[model samples]
Target: MTDTILEVRDLRTSFFTENFEVKAVDGVNFSVPKGKTLGVVGESGSGKSITSLSILRLIQNPGKVVGGQVLFKGEDLLEKSEAQMRKIRGNKISMIFQEPMTSLNPVYTVGQQIGEAFQIHEKLNKKESIKRSVRC
Candidate 1:
């Protein structure tokens, strides 16, 4: 089996701002092998977030994944439907944002928020999810 867990080739993302089209990710390429981490380091407006959003197919209106092949586990994620992509997003591939405080909901308790991940991905019962979360 191939060692690559995720591969992004010639990935491109663009946004239309009234005046012109801005290419956030311009033909970027990288691969992450299994059991390894890939760090994207750059200044703001460097297309780091856009690249992740495209991988997740989470780009909003006026912004689009113009071109790319995002292969996860040998599957072409870019070619998958939204519903199909959703299944892979939090389950097969998970991401922790740079700022956990902002990523989390302030109103909910930490346990409650963490339990939601189990509920969504594992479909675990609330009690069991909470128990599992506490162990973490």
Candidate 2:
């Protein structure tokens, strides 16, 4: 095997309302090997974003991942606690929102935002993170 980095099996997500439920993502399945990328393409509102959100466990109120497993490096992310997920997110994995304008804080420089990741994930001091960000 080439070493599977991520595997999503029977992934499902839904939005619940008072009267009905919208199956945003239903039975999605795929795998990506290490050093590979998976591109999900579809029409707008075809569950692409929902699938990504569910994988990251970012689904909020009214939206739930009702089923399936998101395996990252052979571990089930769905079974991880919220605190665990917090560490995994931004460190092990992240979502780059489609909207660039709203994704970052305009007040801060791009380098500052980028360095924050290193600070949080790698436990680097602010000075070290800034240096690393500059090199990138």
Best by TM-score: 2
Instruction: Write one digit per residue (lDDT tens) for candidate 2, span 1-136.
Output: 5599999999999999999999999999999999988898999999999999999999998999999999999999999999999899888898888887998899998888889989998999988999999997
Q: Which RMSD values do the candidates have, in order?
A: 1.6, 1.3
Q: lDDT values of the candidates?
A: 0.88, 0.93
Question: Model 1 over residues 42-97: C-alpha lDDT tens digits?
Answer: 99989898899888898998999999799999888989988997788767877666
**Model 1 worst lDDT window (10 residues):** 89-98
Q: Who wins the lDDT comparison?
A: 2
Clashing pairs in 2: none
In terms of lDDT, model 2 sits at: 0.93
